[model samples]
Target: MEARERVVKMGALKHHSIVRRILTLVVSMVILIALVNSAVINTMIYRQLLTEYKSKGIAISQSIADSASDILLFRDPATIQSLLDQHLTINGVAYLVLEDAENNIVAHTFVPQVPQALRTIYAGKRTTTATTAFHRLPGLGNVYEISQPILFGEIGIIHVGMSLKPIHHSMLKVVAILIPILLVVLITALFVFRSRLRFVTRPLVELADYTKHLAGHNFEQSLPEQGAIRAIAAEHNDEVGRLSETIVSLEDAIMTYIGDLKRTTAAKQKIESELMIARQIQLGMLPKSTDNTAFETVKIASYLEPAREVGGDFFDFINVGEDVYIVAGDVSGKGVSAAIFMATTMMLIKAKAQEHIPPQELMVSVNNQLIALNENMLFVTVFCGKINRYTGIFSYVNAGHPAPFIKRKNEALEIPLTGGMALGVDYHHYYQQRELQLENNDTICLYTDGISEAMDVAQNQYTEARLAQCIGQSKAVSAHELMDDILQDVRIFSDGADQSDDITVLLASWCHASASVSSELGVHFTNDLSEIAKLHQVVDIYSQANGLTKTLQHNLKLVLEELIANTISYGYRDHEIHDIKVFFTVVNNALNMRIEDDGIPFNPLEDAPEVDHSLSLEDMPVGGLGIHIVKNFVDTIHYERQDHLNVVEFTKSLGETA
Candidate 1:
């Protein structure tokens, strides 16, 4: 039964409207013909049987009427009985009866039995015209009667009745004939319908299965259109063929797109890699380190940070005998092209520096070189200077660059060297230079515009005023210390905004010979107090050998005391005993001392608290005044914290006036 249900469902899935219509027409025609034939057959058979019965009744009534007239005229009851017996002998006749006027029975016939009740009913009513009776006999079946008037001057009434057994038998025979014919028609229709449905539905079932596989992304299968199914395919040419063609086209397009994307990605990666290499080469062009102690009293500290892959800011320093040349410049643009032009400008400056020319002459030569190679119309703003370390004089040329600051003693001021267009403007342009004196403890700071033009997170520029203020506050620090402090301050102000350009600072200080003697002393000590006493003994030997003055002796003693106390106290804050070394030198009659310690770095000079002179001695802080007094007596001091050693140097002139 389950298999039969599945077959029926499969037939429904594949059934076509045309085949369904034909099956419906066949079934309807068969049912309509059966209904019409059954109705006509029943109607004709009933009418024929009723007519025959009426005719038989008429004939029997006429015969009985004649017999009744004879009986009444001749009074022969035997004749009537004979007539009734004759009629009863015929087939399907059950009984016969006759009644006269006044309800008196004339004659009666019974075949194998008639009920006494029927006889009584016949005797109860009488008429002069015809009368009829019907009865069911026990062995003779249904009966019919007919009667007629005697009409011998209306002497008596006559009636006749007969059976209808033949009509019932005929109806049963008709039903027996029609039932087998209907069964044969129904059986033939079932076989014929199954065969036709197979022809129509088999190809459709195959097509449905193929479509299911295709929906699951399996495009490799194809359908065979043949026979009756091919006729359907020929009608509309099959939508499945169009779908397969579209899939092929889409696959081709996807492959082409993927190939193009891969090629484009490779090309982009190659370009990016080349740009990185170019950036590295640009960085490699800058100077690494300067010649050590190359100039008498000059130091330069520079910093460069590019905002992008490359930059255009540069600085160069050259020493020519008694004079040192310094150049700090910024090109007009940024990136690789600007970096190329900056390199060219540095080469020109180097050539000019070696020629022993004045700053104005050097700028004129460098400008000619730049303008000759200025096909791209590139330009650079530069501040170039040539300083005489021996005379403490500087001659500089400014070409649209920010003015350099000069810290002379306690006063910090900007140099007034102004005039000349930037390089690459005109080939034969004249450059001007201004000369100024650098006093003792004076600092000449040369820088690029990147310093003063650096911006903070708020987009505010680190203006020249702020730069000057930072420089003034750090005047007591050495050249390197001052530069470090300024960079730290700028970084704090900028708050992680990129250093937009190069930062280059060069500081030069002049120390006279007479002021150098009061500063030079050296000592060495151990963890033992005897070793410290021995260090004092060695210092006395050197002071006596050099014939030092009382004031010089007092200053040297104080400097040594501070140096030893710092090494013994905070330098070994973990209480680890260590050795210390000190060296003294006199260059051109100026005293210089160098002290070294194998302890943690602690620079008393830098960390010293500022003294509030307004407060009285009783109210004054006692801890920081030691380094302050040491600084007041010395002309110049420098400290370096190198691996496991703190090196501090002190310098002063020997003359009483210093």
Candidate 2:
């Protein structure tokens, strides 16, 4: 109510101010017009009155001159005086005079005597037309003094005085009449105009108040119909009504927009939550970094940062028999869909690489799988390679991916590409494999375009030349340090600019290291019961040398005994001797083991029987107990058939549980 009152007061103030200004302007104009009209009327009346008085004075003087001409010829003063008196009775004729031929006044009608001022007239001077002159006589006031000739100046002239008092009196009377009429008209117009103005301005004032009310209130709610707003809208059929209607419609639109915005905001929040979860899942799909000591011949490190909650770039590295397989890929777009595609591609690449697929073959296979599954026609660029630790030979394939830098003895050089299209574009696209022999301590840096194309505030890109320069300038001694140096340099170059794409970097450095009791342990023995003791002896020596926990050693002994005993019993159909190669390494508090045996094909990861916890111990399966116990003791396991050999690899974290 208080707000409404304020609005009303404001509207009233505005209305009154406008009305008062308009009234003041109009009244001033009316008064000025009236004064001008009165001036014009007075001028016209004065002109008409002066002309009439002069005409009347001229006639009276002429009549007296003619009458006195005969009267003076007989020398009759009585008749001449009578004629002068008779003409004096005419209005505006102040006085009349008659003179003899000898300039003697024959008859005159002044107050008591004719003033001397008029007596100076010379009758000797004649005029063909009657002439008049104005003068202020001593007794008579202002008058037009007319001198008339009598019979061509043979007789004396007649002097007639026409007073100007009638013109003054007539002007005064006109003013009196005009002033009253003007006042009456002005008063009437003012009253009518003020009344009509109130009628017109009242609605406008209400509209202003209602508009102010609308501005103060929330527009999300429907406008009330029982107020000044409604009154003005219903009562008027003009611009005011249309304006009110438009305002109401605007409020409705605002309400709808606010509702939709709320829904959209909630939906967006939900999608963001889902995307965050998906980001975690996508990150989980990438390979976890292992300790540098895990591989005796290569040190590996990787860095990945998505531009958004989820991104399209991915990297993976895994041990492939005697070689280290590494891959880096980038999808075409960013966000959730790209992340999904990236996860799919990474899984495919890892699975194919684990199967001992070559770099070029893996690209062809993963590309076909992606093409069959890609409904959005999205594609991914990949650079995959296999580094042979024993031979220092690096074989790689580039599928429309950026070239990697090879840092050899402090010199950074780009590895030339064996051209191939990005995956998922054409299923028939062929990819070529290129080989480069790696030297000891040589670092290979693989990265996505995000590193090279990073922009600064000036829109300058951190190009490939910059990457090579950064790599060349780096004083890092290991793959992890070099990777960090490259990433840091890129960030410094970007200088707080927005990241436009996902960034990924993978580095691998090759070096020679002997297999010793400190870092690694390996042995080769026949699948004979006597040689199982040799495996135990080697594991015991390596554990004691490396300070491994007793529980880890026990778990390792139990798993190896179970797997090798099963292999000797069931893995071979022939009784001939079969050799098994066993290697162990302690990397970052975890024990990594690789087993290769030239026996019948067996994949312990999949061929292992399922252990049912629901069954009693006596009812439990018999053939799968060894594999089940091995799985329970180990953290991870991978099995593959490579070159007719069953290779089983597993890692056990050095935690209390084993």
Candidate 3:
């Protein structure tokens, strides 16, 4: 039992010794790691400070050289010496020297009591020296000896020896500064490292806890993905940069996905609202059927096709007793603003029609209204007319509007009328009225510019000539049939092209007349004396048809003779050959005659010489009195120059005097 007890004691002692040795080894290893880390950090700080000191020293040296040269040039020795003394007082600038050409120091500023051996060694050097010598100096810790040779003209060399007192003082001051700084850095690093280690380890611990929690079906807390834990795992390189970029990309993708959903929902709502408004506005702009039955024998058919969600086309019909007013207009541009303008135009036309205003007067009012409200310079093209339904007389006005096609018994003719500028361009514009006598079963077709300007896939317009031909062929069809044929033909020509603007059409036919009086006469005359007899025939036709009084016939005969003689003499004066065309149409108890010439733009009203009527015929300056006689007897005369054709129309309203 005693030997067993001793063996146990020995075993316990050996175990204790082994534990103490392991503890000592661990402690020594910890001290070594700490010492190595401190040495590395200190070396980095020392190198940084040394680099700063070297740069400062070089800068100071260059500055001193520049200052000395400036003083020598200016011959200012006091300023040079003062600058040297100031440099010596600054920290880290151990010494400063300004020497003359002779081997004598001109200005030397140094700390007192430099070492003797170092001074002797510096003095012995023959050539200019640049070396840092270490020495012991009085009242200064370790010192550096820097020597340089200075030359000023042809004198002997001047040696400059300066003790590096400021440098030593700066080094001692650095040590003093470093003691507290190092202490703070050490304490801060210790706390920071502890915090960082915890920061790194805490996330790992949390991840482990999360795994444990997940095993228990609990996913309440999330792991922190950034900071120290991420730094350790990321390991700074391309991998870290890529991981950061990937996370940012994923975040952006999530944000974009959410935004897309919101935008889709809002867009759907907006489209629905727009469609509803378009349906309401479209239904409201159409003419009501209750007002159509007031006319005695007037037929009206219209079609409005909207290209998009809204249209800019509009048409209206208003009947007042025996008269009927019709309007077809298109506002420029499209969408909501155009729709608003269309509504305003419709209301203005309706209001003016209700006042029994003539088509030309109504157009002038509308133009003035548009110009007043037109801050954006928006204009509308309108073709407006008033039909004396009982008399079968069609009076119309065009405001830069496309001409309507008239399906006569024999031909489809565009109404030959002058149009003014578009509405909203100028308030002073005047639209002229034109009258046409429509017989029974004659159809008048009016349309918007969209029909003529419609383009095919290849961008070819459905031209006006093609439209005229189409109407001429379909004159026998019903109003509805005519509209359908024209619209279908336009669509076929367009060849599946996108509808760019609104398409609108209005067709009206006169089915009866109270007193069908036709005074249609044609005369062909040239600038020749032999064709003068046709003018008598023209006056005779008008006199017999209207049963004109004897005095009116004489006046008409005199005006016709004077106009014919003027054209035969002076119209073809410059050209060798020229044909004159005269057309006469009496509608609504008014006789209208148009005279066309290919001659130059000369207005008889303007160019006709004023006659001193008191002079004798031979003394009358021969050419002036003829046009003056025609102007005095005519009710109204107007001139227009279009292309190369000069047209003058004379209106003799039989209702005015006969």
Candidate 4:
């Protein structure tokens, strides 16, 4: 209902816009003017005609009075009456009467003149000439009554009355001719004015329409081209033309701005995506905290938090024989530059630590290499050391970094770290070797300045004393728990202050070596793929017995089908009996699977060609998806040619890697 009302109102507005209302106003004004003019002219003409008729009556009465002087003096009314009768023959002249000055009827036409017995027999006025007045006599129409002095009121007044019919008829004739011509002129004027109005308003209306179209994004109708818009500009050099040109200019400017905005938005989104990917890759490079883990010969945990998406803090661990190496480092500055330096430094440290090199000696080699490759002259502070898990011999190098704290399980006293020259500061600087024999329950907490120098909302640094106190209070907590408690305390102390630098903590202790753990499940099945049921039963029993999650069981089932199916489907050249062996082990906090089949030598890892994920389903190749799924679920894959057996083994860490 409202829509209908709106449509009606809009239609009215549309009709009214194009000179329709203006034309109505013009026509109304013209008709009013014509009627007023006609009325005024007719009134003036009627008055003038009445005046002339009165004057004629006066003259005729005077003439009759002059000639009737002799008759009236002798009192003979016959001659006087004959003179009055002659005047009555004229058209529109109803009657003429000659009466005595005493108002006695003397002569009259069409009726007998009243005698002195009448009501107004002698209504008199003293005048030298004729005087006239109007009268509406019953059945005689409108008439004029005039009287004049005959022989200076001596002979008797000669009264002459004339009807107004002739004047009214003449006035009617004039109006009859004027009205039709006025109507025709008015109609023609309306048409001409409306046509002229359209020319002036058409461009403006179209400009409004086009502007609305652009704003509404209603592109069903094609927009006018530049040439067409320019035509409007050239057609009239008025405001409408200027407006049209302005609309065209605005359209171009708006479109250009929108396009630039889209491009800028897309580029920003792309940069954000790359930064997200860089953050994942960076975090993945650092080892996860693992003090809760019961393996690795010690309880070592690490937490590296960046102020930004990427930061320059790093931590590492390596197990060689009965010794565990722990390292924590910070690159100079922060953000991207520091992150790059941190990555390079981590690679170099891991490479050297794997060789079982001494900490001080390893720092010497790492520092020189950094100086040679450090075109930006960046420096790094590192605290790297090795701890004998059994003998509790802690040996380390402190390179321009904060001291590593040694807190005993039962003592509150804090051991401060020693300082030396920072790496990349000199090409041949030898790092200091410091050894502190730790007791069985002593803990070593290595850190970057980001922790000791961390600021709260009040701009107060956490300070080395605070870290020592926190560790002392939390001394009985596990290594991972202690790290978490320190972080939580710092977070609460900061009171939501943003982490302004890279905060890294590498915690380790040569307390007790975790008891070794291992799980093995092997099932033997024939060549038939349906015999896979026996393999599934073997894995399910082992998984339930070891408290493995249901999810792992399902994943292992799919793994069995993919790995064993490949062997059964393609390993054999004939329909003959073949053996497939599948086994699983839980060792060193990791789940390891080894599949050995007496099939052709096929390394699934290297043989599985890379898949193009960008391809559509119809265009994507189908066979290697199962292998890809297995890799996604598993952390590591190893393929070895053990004699005639194709041994495919993979391991997934149950906790952080050492």
* Alpha-carbon local distance difference test for all models: 0.69, 0.84, 0.68, 0.76
TM-score of 1: 0.43
Please provide the root mean square deviation of candidate 2 (C-alpha atoms, Å).
13.4
TM-scores of all models?
A: 0.43, 0.57, 0.41, 0.64
Report the C-alpha lDDT of model 3 over 1-658, residue by residue, as the tens digit: 5754555465556544554565456546655765675566556665565556555554565566545655655657688678878887767655565555433445656545334654465453444433444556454444444433222233222222234444444556766775566567666765665555454434444333333333333222322433433453465345434554454344445556657877898898898788768757765777753323324357777777877677678888887645789888888888777777888888888999999888999999999998888787778888899887666799999888898998876578897655677777877797889898987877788988789888999999998888888888874456677777889889899989998888888888776632222366555667776556645644654565567666667777787677767777766657576788877787677778788878766778888778785887678685577788888888988888878878888887776654
Error of 2 at 58 (Å): 3.8
Expressed as tens digits, the lDDT of each residue in 1-658 for candidate 4 is: 5754555455446646657777878888998999998999899999898778877787777777778777888887676667777878866667776667675667778565443322253355445567776776666778777877678876677767788888989998988888988989888887888887887777765665566557655333336555666688889889989988888877777777777888899999998788778778889998776547432347887888888878888888876655688998989998778888988998898888888888988999999889888999889988888987656788888888877787787454544455678888898996778787887656788888888888998899999888888888884567787788889888888888877887888888665322211266565667787667655655565565566677777777777778788778787777779888777788888888888888878888778867887999898987887678777777788889899998989886655422
Clashing pairs in 2: none
Segments in model 2 whose C-alpha atoms lie over 4 Å from true places: 1-14, 70-91, 97-125, 136-142, 202-309, 316-327, 331-334, 344-405, 412-441, 449-501, 508-658
Model 2, 349-432: lDDT tens digits are 988988887898989999999999999999999999999866679999999999999888789989899999999999878899
lDDT of 1: 0.69
Root-mean-square deviation per candidate: 17.5, 13.4, 32.1, 14.6
Q: Please give, for residues 444-472, the per-residue lDDT of candidate 1 as tens digits.
A: 77777788888887789998888888887
Evaluated at residue 14, the lDDT of candidate 3 is: 51
Off by over 4 Å in 3: 1-252, 264-272, 275-279, 288-296, 513-658
Question: Which has the higher lDDT value, candidate number 1 or candidate number 2?
Answer: 2
Model 1 lDDT, residue 456, Cα: 88
Clashes (backbone N, CA, C under 3 Å), per candidate, total 28, 0, 9, 0
Among these predictions, the greatest lDDT belongs to 2
Whose TM-score is greatest here?
4
RMSD of 3: 32.1
